[model samples]
Target chain A: MEAAPPESAAPITPVLVAEHLERKLPGDPPVTLVTDIDLAIEPGKFTAIVGPSGCGKSSLLYLLGLIDRPTDGRLLLEGRDMMPLSGDERAQIRLRHFGFVFQFHFLLPEFTALDNVMMPIRRLGRLSLPGARERASDLLTSMGLGDKLHKPPDHLSGGERQRVAIARAMANNPLLVLGDEPTGNLDSTNSARVVELFRELAHEQGRAVVCVTHDPGIAEVADIRVSMLDGRICEVLRQT
Target chain B: MFPRLGLLLHIAAMHLLVRRRQTLVATSGVAVGVGFFLAVSALMVGSQTDFVKTLIAAAPHIIISDELRSPSPQPGVREYGKTGAVELHGYKVRNEVRGIKDWQQILREIDAMPGAIGSPSLSGAVTLRQGGRDEPLGVVGIDPTIETRVSTISEKLRAGRLIDLERVQGGVIIGEDLAERLGLGMGDIVAATSARGVSRSLRIVGLFKKGQSGLGSGTGYMLLREAQSLLGRPFVINRLGVKLPDPYTADAVAKQLEARHGYKAESWQERSADFLGLLLTRNVIMYTVVSAILLVASFGIYTAVSNSVTDKRRDIAIMRSMGFSQGDLQFVFVVEGMALAVAGVIAGWLFGFALMTVLGSLEFPIQGEVRHLPLDRSTRQYLIAAAASLFAGIFAAWLPARKTALVDPVDILRGAV
Candidate 1:
């Protein structure tokens, strides 16, 4: 059992750090996405990257999530160099320590809510069948989806499907959770609920949470607000 | 066991279930292919097996005749290569016995060998006269007891017993067609004139029906003693028939026996070479049809999987993000094809068995009795059909599965933010 963090919330070792990260798409005229980014993601903090559509905020989030490779920078996971790892190795790392929630629920339409949550745990192979099932059921129950555990994504409402996606993201107990407009398609109430869930996932569970979104709700509530313009972070504000 | 096999199968099953219509069409295509392959192959191969068995049972596995495989070279050809300016036209050959002199001893030797029986027969062309009508025919003289062990002639007897040739003195057995053509009946006497110009009266003792037109209309059989007296060929047998337990070994046995006896030993297979050639041609045609069916069936699976991959692009991206490897995705899709193929095999077996049963129950008219269609319903046919169906299904799905692996989650998910 872990004791709750004190009110002071003393600084601790960062879980991920990006040092001057950059990515360029190769072509006759190479297109540059993100440039000169220096950021550290501390545990127990919800960080939101907010910008215009072409500001490369999602690109930066992708780089941090290990889902995309940086063209010219060093990335460290818990201070260990991630620059030399292969794509497959990066995917493994993502599977083991990072969970992602996209704007669309993106649940495999053929699988039930419980199966969607169980997919990651089953892939990690750390738990047996019954154990994985139990974990998914318990997580869905906690998310108020116990009644809809066996329903497919199409059978659920927008809000319920998004909750299932969130539950899926946290199924593996990942150290970091990354989302790209996780509540973009949800109603206002659902968006607010999703924001509170991300906040809880970070503050209560002690995990780093990062979101790239145009939604002002997430921007207003995030613990750390990162504002970017034309592929560069122009502002970083921390709440007291 | 495969790693994460249960999860992979679950995912594959879910995808297939979601696209039930496409799956059914694909599976039914394979099932129809398998059913046709099994049913047609069984019928064709079955008929071929029936024909070969009939040929085998009709006569001895090997026939040792009083003849030379290669006649001795002429003196002129041996000495001068036929170009010495001395054209030898007139021929005078050495005088020797007309038949095998020690046939009884050869028969005894063959009988001593394991799983072999040898029977002797004397055959020649003769003219028969019945009430002013004269018909030239071929006749064979056989011992009643030894003939039964080597040939199927005893089974063809329709009227009189084979041993009646010995029971009724001066008796002969002739085909029913030949007897009818001569207007002769059992116990009637006919004059038999041998090629040697000797004549004798023979009583009709037996009537048989043969499948061959030539044999049924112009052949006769008699006791060996009577043929010897009538043909003026005493105590000499011209042919020895050897039967073996395994007909397939006839060629080797024939070669060895011919080498030892300095006679022309013809195996049944050698005699049926033309028939076997026809059979081979037919089998090639059958397999080509079967292959075409499977190829078409494979196209159905390929189309189904390719369409599924296109329709489920979003699911593929999410699964990749969830840590499922590309190889894992490919395996799942290919196993989807294998699942359909297995189901097809099961369904195909039922359909094929019903087809064979229906065919086997049908009767065709032959001579005076009924004969059902021959069917080779061996277990091996099912195994071979299943193996082929599965292999074709796997190969067909493999290309689409590879395409599934190349799916770019980044491209598909770029708009999420």
Candidate 2:
């Protein structure tokens, strides 16, 4: 697989930062999901978090994506403290600045690919219906899914479905894109194609991309890799 | 805002479409409830209005009687009021002539009241004797011109005009059935004796038919002056029949009259209180039964929504991760429920209208007359049915919508994928 190119000459600015984050589920003996996690995600870089099963890779990704709250930490989005925000405020921030993809495409089966991509655009309510439709079409076409926009998720193949989900995640022009094993369900060729697309999304569009994966191929293509062991980050690898 | 709302509606419609069978079942449940509610309410309200119309047409809105509900003190007792409270042995109550003294002045006062037209009348018991056959009858004395304004007696005349009684002195209007029973006709003279034994021969000038057996066979009308002379009670009126522009205000008007004037004024509604009370009770029972149907339909909605929520758990988690708020999820489901209710309401209205039209076209015997079934096509009944169905659907969907809104997307995602 061809590795992603190094960062351009433009100075890097961090889009998301986490300091001393800790997540513990309430129990007789609290189950710690992640601990002492400190990270900064810069724009125009593709980062991969790799770990064995149950080693907090997905948990750390969820925390970074703002989908899960940490028990003790300060998370800053674009240098603004996100901990004091209300649930609705956090949702608004997610709508404007963050996008997510899961291992399962998670596209609503009842909606056409175009509608699924338009979901975030319509939810943000910044675009008219025609505008949203146009934007969704553009994104799908960019993902090489022009002909399949009107098809339902069930009608599409696995790679097509994941690509549709990616187009949906980028619908609102979010600053950061987070994926949890997005290519885990794809074959080798489709997984390599998805990783190439992620690298292009980060380098060409100047957006931060963070993905959690066990696939060594995905980590090899990423510009930076963070490995986790027993709920803690154990190693950081950067490819020049 | 419009785009967001459209998206929510789109999603809600899509969810419902995914489970078309359950949607149909729930919608039909509400439809049936609303349909029955409209049909039954229209029938009951229609019959009530029809009965009231007949009652209003049959009699005056208010009747002021000269006789007091309680006995008046004797002149001697009034003159020696409370003098040592003397108790008399063998005291007996004697029946005296009952008539309104100074009734012309009272009539003038009543006529001056707003929206009121009062006519003096004297009703007494008499017997008609013709061909050696005697039948007991009620003799009503009325002024031809004033009585026509207060009662529908003029419209009921079968042979001659009520005004014809004025042209012929000592002329009376008898019901067609009464005239037939007595073997008498217009221009025929019949011997009549008052309860006081005063006897006279009166000519039948007009015949009236009211479609009621008792009224047709036992009542007669004559000139007020002639009836007073024959009954040995000249210059006396025992009753005042009153008509108003709006008959529904009769009770309030009657109360006002009774308070101002000491005569016992009774409204038509007051006279028929027992029947009206029965009608009201029937209405209560009908609403209870129909509301139970809606309640059952609401349970159908509840189950349908609950099932949808369970099936859409993964989709819900996905939407939440896509940045949809809790209110958005709740709004989508609630919109689904409201859509079903609205569709059902429309269907029910059409169903009820069709039923009413069919029923109204059929003829049935009612009180010896063939008529169409009463079915009120009032918009109020439609609104009530719609409002009830909507309320039930929303209430039923509330629990499931709340549950769906409170769903933890992480929990669902962890288990689902």
Best model per TM-score = 1
Candidate 2 lDDT, B1-417, residue by residue in tens: 889999999999999998999999988888888887888888888988988888887788999998676678875576566786766667666666779877888788878978789989898888999999998878988999998788778877788988887889889998888888889999999999998899999999999875763265688998999999888899898998889889899999898888877789999999889978998898899888888987887887888888888888899888888888888988888888888888778887888788788878899887566988788888999998888889989878877999876678777766575
Cα distance off (Å), candidate 2, residue A70? 1.4
Docking level of model 1: medium
Q: Where is model 1 more than 4 Å wrong at Cα?
A: A1-11, B1-3, B73-92
What's the C-alpha lDDT at position B267 in model 2? 95
**Which pairs, if any, clash in model 2?**
none
- Interface DockQ of each model: 0.53, 0.68
Off-target runs (Cα >4 Å) in candidate 2 are A1-11, B82-97, B185-187, B208-216, B259-261
lDDT of 1 by residue, A162-223 (tens): 99999999999999999998888999999999999999999999999999988998998999
Compose the digit string of candidate 1's lDDT tens values, residues B103-185.
Answer: 87888889998989998889888899988899987788889887877777777888888878889888888888788889998
lDDT of 1 at B323: 72
Span of ten consecutive residues with least summed lDDT in model 2 chain A: A1-10
Worst 10 residues of 1 chain B by lDDT: B209-218
Q: In each prediction, how many residue pairs overlap at the backbone (N, C-alpha, C within less than 3 A)?
A: 0, 0
lDDT, model 2 = 0.87
lDDT of 2 by residue, A41-127 (tens): 888889999999999988888888777899999898878899998777878888889889889999999999999999999999999
